[model samples]
Target: MSITARLLRYFAFFWILFLCAGTIYQYINFKHDTYFIHLKQTAVATGWYLPAFYCHIFGSSIILLAGFFQFSKTVYNNRPLHKALGKLYVFGVLFFAAPGAYVMTLFINRGGFVFASFFIQNTLWVIFTLSAFLLVKNGKIDAHVKMMHRSYALAFGAVMLRFYIWLFMRLGIGVDFENNYIIISFLSWVPNLILVELINRYNKCPYRTLQN
Candidate 1:
């Protein structure tokens, strides 16, 4: 790895670990506290909050770490671990995270605009993930890798969403809660995709071709 690639790898590793820690904290809160806030809301509305929340929290957290390692050429060269993690990542997203996201999208506040944004994000997330899986199944390794990068970028929205929320609150750019959420809903994953594009364009890394 070049100096820049090494630095990027370290940054990605620690950033993902940080997100995993945050997610695990949420899991602990739900597991121990019964997620009383959500339970109360669910009592008022049949949202199935616990299942959906747990699915997204756990599934996404697990996938963040799994997917981070996936970018390492070392791991990708190790066929057994690479394939194992790839299957786990796909299964987690397909069965748990994406489904949970779609279900939870029904409960987003601030009305239709926010709902549409999240709905689109969740839908594309699933589509990209499925494409990645299908590409790999058909032996299109380069395409599969590109698609997986795209899918994982969207998945990282959980972290980027929180960051945007915090940053905007600090700056008082859009302090209105509903409006803030509205911005972050689309803001979260869009920058991630753009970043992925820029990295692919500039880095010109062999394994990082954008053949679609």
Candidate 2:
């Protein structure tokens, strides 16, 4: 990779790691009250919420870091390692992250709009991830790569969700907390998927590998 490309890749990798680390830190003590301040009522009301929350948190963090390396030429060339990480990423999303997100969607206290946003996003994440796994199994490498890109885009929404929440708070956008959250619920994943689609289109040339 060119120096610029390498720098950008490392930047993104570390940025994702930083976000994941910060999120994991919040739950380091495994206390139900740590990040569940607002969801305490829901947690008490539903027996499944805490389990789903932990699954999504830890599972998504592992997949986010693993998925980043999926695009690396070095990793891609190492078939055993690539397949191992691919399985990790796929299973992480399908069995843990996506399922957990689906369960959590049921408990979203935000209005229907926010709930719908998360439901759809989570649905797409599962579909894209499953499709990628199936495609690779069938030896459809090119299509598999494309679908994996889409899957990872949705996965990155976790980080984007937090970043947007922080940004909105800093910029004083959508001053109402409920309204702000509603906006962020959609903002989190839509733009990431759109950007991924644009990148896929721009790099459609057969000679252009995803690693580039």
Compare the candidates by TM-score and give the number of the best one. 2
RMSD of 2: 3.1
Q: Highest lDDT among the candidates is held by which one?
A: 2
Estimate the Cα RMSD of every predicted model relative to the unseen true structure: 3.5, 3.1
lDDT of 1 by residue, 126-211 (tens): 99999999998887766777788789999988777776777887887764665667777889888889988776566554664322
Residue 14, candidate 1: Cα error in Å is 3.0
Instruction: List TM-scores for all candidates, in order.
Output: 0.84, 0.89
lDDT score at residue 7, model 1, on the 0-100 scale: 94
lDDT value, candidate 1, whole model:
0.79
Over the stretch 7-79, how does candidate 2's per-residue lDDT look in tens digits?
9677678779888898789886777666454546655567888788889989999999999988877898777
**Candidate 2 Cα outliers beyond 4 Å, as residue runs:** 1-11, 35-38, 205-212
- Predict model 2's lDDT versus the native: 0.83
Deviation in angstroms for 192 in model 1?
A: 1.4
